[model samples]
Target chain A: MDSTVTTATNESVWGGGNQPLGASYGKLMMWFFLVSDALTFSGFLASYGFSRFKFIETWPIAELVFTHVPFFHGDYPLYYVAFMTFILIMSSVTMVLAVDAGHKMQQTRVIWYLFLTIIGGAIFVGSQAWEWSTFIRGDYGALETKGGRILQFVKADTGERAALADFAKNIPSEREDLQRDKGLWFQSEGYLTSRSVDEVVEGFVANPNILIRTETINDDNHKTVLTREESLKRIKDAAHVVEGANLIHNEYGSRLFADFFFFITGFHGFHVFSGVMINIIIFFNVILGTYERRGHYEMVEKIGLYWHFVDLVWVFVFTFFYLV
Target chain B: MAHAHKLEIFRGLLKFKTNVQKIWAVLVFLTIVTTIEVALGIIKPQALTHSHFLGMKVLNWIFITLTLVKAYYIAWDFMHLRDEKNSLRRAIVWTPIFLVLYLIFILLFEADYIYNVFKFGFVKWNF
Candidate 1:
């Protein structure tokens, strides 16, 4: 039995020690979790790359499509997203400092650094929300045709985008007088009078020249755009242009890109949020002298691993979502 | 009096108090590198734009190189990988390096294949 036990011990890796790497159980678990998380994020990014390849052409240019605002209607490129990335990276720096302070048993410093990290994370989340809202609202709205294709207008002169509202004119309401009472015989019932599909189709067909195609319009300059004379004539006949995004095409951008962007970034934002919460908990513990009592700041080091993992994820996300 | 002298000697030898200063210097260097990356990305020199190395655009190569540098500092210094033993360090670093490289190779090849299909295949996505 003794010989067998000796052989087993010799065969074991890491000098037969159970506690290899000298890492605490918690830290080891964190490493494992991070590895798995890394794989999960890589899967999402790979899928995105594959889809991008599958739709290489006709896919929207990310920079051009993403530029828009609610109040300001003009061209603003990659600056906003770049700033958000900087914010997240800076937050990671603060987190590292906080962990360092914890190791030194400097409770006050830890508190301050952790607070800064939390603030940075909150700002990032807010910026992501703004980005999502802008994406959902769209900038230069595209026309969704019956064939499920998006047709966007570009300025003929400057190649800037033209909004849907630029080409669409409002049609005056044609409300009929409501009849409260009818002398027709039987029990009175609610009146039902509406334009049926066939009627609407007939109305549209009656004015073939008025049905303006979106492709006929072009952006002319930074400020004002122009619609082709033929398109203008068609619009004069048709009365109104179609107004929002639809199943075939999104006004904001490509539906698939938007969907993937939201899913990936939203997931990452959730991770940042949870990381902040964990940091806060660790912050309180540091202040309460928990690590000081334990004679080491290994807990801080462990949390540092988690914080750095979040930073690493953001780096990849920034590259794929913005730069690439 | 003897114990006090020994304590002073211990502090002198360990230099434990100055780790923070070293860390701050490293952090400053990292900030500079990141700023450089952003600047390069924005400027995108004409020479670099047209040049290709290793089947990738020069700009992409630059970005990857700088990113690796940043990763090095973040892992080796910030995460204290440098302080770890050889086996422990290898376990942490080599695993990720090997796995990520393998993944990139497979994915890039797959992407190129798909691009070829789109270029030559029967299906016409463009209207």
Candidate 2:
């Protein structure tokens, strides 16, 4: 028998009903939205993957990029990001518990679990914002070559990264900031870099211990460091002093790395934020006894699907952006 | 609601005292998998990282596989996709699988072509 033939009614399986395929109308719609949303995310991640693969040699390794932990400043590599992922996955667990409580019509348990889930989401969102700021501010700066490659600095003896401020000679030079009152202010670029390419080049010449590390990754999966003579020649070819990541320049390695970092992680952060807001509304409804009056806590279950979808997306995001 | 599947995970690998216990079980599995992923990322064993399988590092393959496992548990148990009728499940899951896979395949291959152009063609290597 063909299930599509519902002879007794005008509504087909495609039409909305009490329960299509034994699932509520709202729940099914949520699934459809999630599937579409998943595709959107997939598009973003795949593009990021393409960019990473294209510049596989020059692309910044995720370990060196995400090496900052909150409240601790030395190289902590993947610790804080691990904590953030743990929080998000734990929130998914709490959300499932709330849905389970809803199934049993336990109002009190639902409230508590929902509360925990909201807290978990809030923490993840906050942590992501902090991470974005850290990345944008950057750490050790690099000089951009005429060919547009980034040349980083490292201690010759230790091969440890050296900060721009540690070696960049501050030459006293006055530059006027363009303002609305200034002529052609609209054409004005923002704040100038702390030091010019000439200044950094002079500084590099003065310091013999600092070596220039090229964006090219070697067989050992580390950036290629030039010899002292090559380092001098490389810095002389410097066209711009890039301090941190903006849309235009990135000191870490490839500028595309910064772009993908902002777009993909920002999209995920937005999802987590919206999921928290939806959970709050459902939390209020649970508290108001709305589901109890309806004799079913299906609303909670529906939102639980969205919440879990957010978590599932994060799993992929974490793997693609951070781990791989 | 008329739809409620038997509350169990892992094909009843270990019977739980209640649905709450089942929720905890899924949570534990996800945490353990994430821990392993993080540990691997940190240690990054040279053998796994250097070798390529299916055009990716074996370490990366492991991460992707673990992520999918976590996604499966979250979808099936937490979201109660298992409880839904087969038709609904297919409608929700199958629809995107086809479209997303198609888009990813085309775009990723195009990216590889572009990479080749940059590597061998007139586009300067640094730009």
Candidate 3:
């Protein structure tokens, strides 16, 4: 015990000294903060798991839901998401490289690596925004039953997904557009769907090749497709036409699935946004030679920890949300 | 602070001379794992999907395992947790691990119970 205190106190405040964990206070605090952040994410994922389990038979299959790429029109399941995963992982690599260069006081190398990391983060955030827009504007429209169930369409001959536009016939109706100035000034109606429920039902009766695919999953793990008569019977129960996903309704499948998808991914995207902002600030600091003057690049290392933590959370998110 | 990097991965089976080389190696490893995950997810082999273990699909088990492997490499190597002292590593890693497992177990079990209620009982599925 070092009893070298010259004041009235004879013993060291810390048992041995400061940094018993062999880490700086700032680094240790950062680690603790990450731990707490990890738990917050875990709570979200666990709730997601709960909802999935509760609706295990009716939960939407991720491959069918997220098959669209930015420009492509074909079915490419998990492709863009995989691309996003690779981008995040690559950015993590660049961040660690920057930290390594910082260790050696290579200011230029650190700056360049940080620049790459920033670009990677920007690309990821942009991709996420595109994904959210696509999810909001769903591809194939579906019918929402009175019980809040989704009924999609499939071609009877090909067993492939069929869009509502492929079969619905335009039927003129007497329904008036409810605008504020037109009628019911204080009671404006919701956005009217292009095709009404009556038109969809009328189209279904005309198209013999279309079948209704209900939300129920059979023993084969495929959605339960109703026969011709059953499809005719089920169409009468539909109350609304769901075009895309939102907090209330999802054309894909269960409303909970879309809710969790938006909340978890949105929260993660926010994290990436903040991480990019932090990285940019650090990039400017490096350019200004702040660390060089300080004789260490610990600031870069601290931010690197945060960047890697984001990647780590994405790894789990990719697994549970997309893969599992 | 020029700390010496512990450059070996995969239980010391592979070693790198420089930190940069090790970073690339880990990247390749993560990429391969992710590729396998994506491929399996897309194909969804019938045999694996049909089989159930621990009341969950075997395919999901594989995905979760691979995800854990990726998480391990990212945390231990990229975050430099491996180089951190034991106390700090445990403080950051163990707490979440224990709590998350417990939370998942409880929530999943409760969810399964609710699912059964909706399935067998008179209570109907409203949404």
Ranking of all predicted structures according to lDDT, beginning with the best and ending with the worst: 3, 2, 1
Clash pairs detected, candidate 3: none
Model 2 chain A lowest lDDT segment of ten? A1-10
The predicted structure with the larger lDDT, 1 or 3, is 3
* Model 3 chain A poorest ten-residue lDDT run: A1-10
Alpha carbon lDDT of residue B3, candidate 3? 94
In model 2, which residue pairs have backbone atoms overlapping below 3 Å?
none
CA error at residue B50 for candidate 2, angstroms: 1.4
Q: Cα miss at A161, model 2 (Å)?
A: 0.4
Taking the tens digit of each residue's C-alpha lDDT, what string does model 3 give over A1-324?
212222335366555445556678778788889999999999999999999999899999999899989889889989999999999999999999999999999999999999999999999999999999999999889999999999999999999998889899899769666778877657878766768888888898999999999998898888999999999998988999989899999999999999999999999999999999999999999999999999999999999999999999999999999999
Candidate 2 displacement at residue A63 in angstroms: 0.7
Tens-place lDDT per residue, model 1, B43-95, is 66778756778765687677777667776766665566565545566767777
DockQ of each: 0.16, 0.66, 0.62
Model 1 alpha-carbon drift over 4 Å, by segment: A1-18, A68-74, A145-149, A171-249, B1-17
Per-residue lDDT tens digits for candidate 2, residues A1-324, read 214333345556565454536666787788889998998998899888878878777888888888899888698888898899899889988998888888888999999999999999999999999999998888888889888789999999999998877788878877776667777746765757777887788888999999999988898877899999999876777898888797778888898888888898999899999999999999999999999999999999888889989988988988988898
Report lDDT per candidate: 0.62, 0.85, 0.92
TM-score of every prediction relative to native: 0.73, 0.94, 0.95
Residue A320, candidate 2: how far off, in angstroms? 0.6
